[model samples]
Target: MVAYRSKVVERIELPARERRERALEEAGYNVFELPSEDVYIDLLTDSGTGAMSDAQWAALMRGDESYAGSRSFDELESAVAEVMGFSRVVPTHQGRGAENVLYGALLSDGDVVPNNTHFDTTRAHVANQGADPVDCPVAGARDPTADGEFKGNFSLERAREVVDDVGAERVPLVIQTITNNSAAGQPVSVENTRQVREFADRIDATFVIDACRFAENAAFVRRREDEFADYAIDEIAREQLRHADAVVMSGKKDGLANAGGFVATDDADLFERCKQRAILYEGFPTYGGMSGRDVAAMAVGLREAVEEGYVTDRLEEIQAFADLLEDAGVPVYTPPGGHAVYLDAGAALPHLDAADFPGQALVCELYREGGVRGVELGSFAFPDTDRPELVRLAVPRRTYHGEHFEHVADTAAAVLEKRESVSGLEVVSEPANPELRHFTAALAPLSD
Candidate 1:
């Protein structure tokens, strides 16, 4: 129902996204491949967040190892302790699975779950528990990296005020780290983490972290903060872990393995319950439904992910791409800082009416010309049918380097030039539900 203007720089005079659509269809293997195999720079997701080291891969695939039965739990446990320093450690199949168990256990139907902001899965978990998640946009925090750190952060003061009003016991406070993907991977500094954690303690509230991106977050902290700048990645990670009572992680991101997730906590009672639930959904507590290979990879990847110049390089790559877009006169999100450039289609396509899919048009154009795939922010990523559309270009961490960026920049210019020829989103099928989308890639001609 409402929309904003997009600041897309003009480039090509007749955007021909339809051609690219044909190309993609011709390829026909793009089935939203599993996160591990997909190279979607994932600025939009912490999926494929971490990758395993050679050593971890070696350990995971050792033929001498029992794929079905291994003392992997010991390895997993030790790794969790070393990384999270939690009093208790439990495993799960993946991040969202852990969230389901965590929120399912903690929240009753009537209870309220509070967080600076909720990741998609975490939010869904709480909602499924028949509880509503209350947003506490902590500490005047408006993307400290508005600028783009790719480490997750939220406002601390907002956290405090929300806890105060909710009376801690009624609403729990959650602090997550690394690639606060929702806010463009902004880093939540150690000091801020401490502040928010302390505030939760002040009110006798529970604090949980959605710590899938811990590795990336730690790397950023080490690079930026004076105190942490000196600490090694491992030490910085430990520091962040000490602040949260519990954290749910998608091992995919931090562990860099193919699949695995865990819940780490100091609360004995709570930890036990979660572990039991995990077994029901996942596997034994020891493996948490993971193979020894994955556990090994996660162990190694966790280490490498924080290694000097690892995460920073990926972030810088994203920044460079954004810089080119900016130089090209395309209005990218202010101060490209993370792993991808988020196109403010609201600002880019102000003329797009509700019936128009401005973001889709941009995405289609980008894809058609450049063989690039970006997410449709409005209806796809954060689908609010009534809200304006936006497009998110996630530069997959390792898929492309400078060359890809240059192509993207030139392609963006081309799209801008043919902005009027850009088409609107055409829906093919609404089917039975709001979540279901079945549409052929069709666009409306941009209105003159």
Candidate 2:
């Protein structure tokens, strides 16, 4: 095992209880709306929240800035081709930008897209294009206590039903989100990916991998899938991508970068259409929506993200964090997941119903109790849907340490102790766009 240390540190002081209370009230009870200064530990997301490595920083310094054909773009393209095994690459500002560009090119009104489970933004982007996003995660995913190694696997049966209902023509894209975020960040198995690929081919739909956390997913495959037990993480990752016709990735997550994303594909027709969409929605095909330096840093981060030692350590750390929560009597998703430890908010606060926003209530309590901010992935995020009430503590890559998670565990335990006291929230104000309302929605305590 390789030892790692923080060569740099930034001091952060926990906000006072009263200040947190005021901040929460001022932000209308939305954790995402709170200022960073009030948050001691921010687990709102892992996207663009990681610390850059020395190599990434060096790459940034040497980045070439040009309007049309920058060397930085070439480097990023080469890295994506090598790591993801795609012949073409298109950079974007972030994961959602990649989603927007790709979906814009493929989706049509009344079309259907299926995945293991679509994350918040993915679902929103699909809806924005007047397309429906269907989730087909295995049944085990809904049961937080189910100790399955690959709960993230897409259900081929469920997908078949969708295809039959919509007709294969209306189903344009079939995606698998590796390390499925919406399903407690669980990892997809290689067998499942191959089967999904076959299913897609049968339906004449394109197979796409929502590969934001592909490296972490590959690590899980190496451990759980018997066939790939001896495979290195990168080798397993390549195999996973090999099953896909195209890939959309958030370089921020597994790439270990602050910001950047890409769409890669072997299909020339789809690649050309995606590039045109990128030119309109993002930027020129070369730079897309990223700065030259960000593109360069992403190139280095992508390679670093798959190093055997680094990927293994990342999984071990997340598992250790989950162990801490379980030891504290906190209800967490079993077997842990690649990036986050999801709290079963419904189990913790059984008194609160789905309409009461149990997950958001838990998020509020955590921030007020310990200045720790976590995001809700339940009714609040997917309103009117039968999703699990989960509060996700997404640890940023190479950011917080064990002490931080220890504090989170203790805080969560405290919240569970006073679970009955926690009140559900009613939306006071929200954006007109219901798909992305959770980000800016205002809420007040539910009336007794």
Candidate 3:
């Protein structure tokens, strides 16, 4: 494959390794608490951190700043229809904004929403609306090293059980998160999505897709699914969307934009309801919570993200980085998910218990040793859950080249070399609110 060349016009000088360690320790061993200037390779998330293309920058300058009936909105709507096959689009500031609008409009007290696996914000929104979020992921998904091609798939039997237990009337929505984030960024197969749509039809529940990484998921489908082997990535994406009643997107992820999101559907009634809620919480339907410039940039990004060359290259880079860690004897999720590589902190640091926050320990150590920052997706993120303790290194799209990934791998290797010296962390200052505590929670090194 031909190399795609882009110029790097900026650089940051990282502080010495010891100074970085001291900074982390002073910040209560929290990577999030550290300043960006002190870090080198920041992998906290792929959301809204990708490098925009020259075309996207050009689109930003063409933005229509009209409060309503903006030309930017029209471009965004047309782009959604062209790429995602959704006729009606409601823009928002980001993915969580899109979730807030959709769930707030659809969910009521005593309602139940079933998904393969809900990400943190998705689950939080459901709970905030007085609704319960349940997971129906396939059994294999629990294992970090599971080789199942569609490990992110929703279990049909489990979905049936949920519907039966709660009664179909009580279940308003069934969601399938394409390239499931919580399940180690695994992709849900096209066949499984069709099955979920069928299940939704039988239960009289609306089928929705959490499509933050839909392009990546569609690329995986083209590669892995036999029926879709000959299909183009965009075609597979459209086919996947055709199986859903609605889609909630975070444009920050797959859209390649800095920040924007939307809730889209063919159902006119659902569109109206979501639009009303969007105006209430977000901005007007035309602009949602985003500015006209953001809308224009997002429109360009939506088209750029699904290009075959770009998606293929992105996944390959992610897999190569994961392979590096795995080769160095680090425990990683096999066959890596679409956007990021997840390290099994529980397995890697078995000496420390979950209560000690082994994942958080590894995260902090990476920052200290190599100025590489990553986020903990384990006990720290979901305290009461029985999920595996994972540390995610989310690679930003088209931001860094091969060398940067290699540097990250080397950093992980350096941390692994002194694994025994790494100590777990204990929470020192937690927020009064239980919702999304990981973002603001403070911790300190546990006494040996």
Best by lDDT, which number?
A: 2
In candidate 1 the C-alpha lDDT for residue 131 amounts to: 69
Regarding TM-score, does 1 or 2 come out ahead? 2
Error of 2 at 363 (Å): 0.1
lDDT for model 3: 0.90
lDDT by residue (tens digit), candidate 2, 1-448: 4347778899998999999999999999999899898999999999999889989999999988797999999998888888878889988999999999898888989999999999888999999999999999998899998878899999999999998898999998999999899999999999999999999999999899999999999999998999998988788999999999889999999888898899999889999999998999899988888889999999999998889888888889889999999999999988799899999999999999998999999999999999999999999988877889999999999888878989999999998888889999989899987878999999998989
Higher-scoring candidate on lDDT, 2 or 3: 2
Candidate 2 clashes between residue pairs 3 or more apart in a chain or in different chains? none
Worst 10 residues of 3 by lDDT: 1-10
For model 1, how does the per-residue alpha-carbon lDDT over 46-140 read when each residue is reduced to its tens digit? 36533344576677775223534456666767777876677577777788788877877787766676665564566667767776665555432
* Clash counts for all predictions: 44, 0, 1
TM-score of each: 0.80, 0.98, 0.98
Put down candidate 3 lDDT per residue, 54-99, tens digits, no spaces.
8899999999889999999999999999999999999999999999
| Cα deviation of 193, candidate 2, in Å | 0.7
Candidate 1 worst ten-residue window by lDDT: 1-10
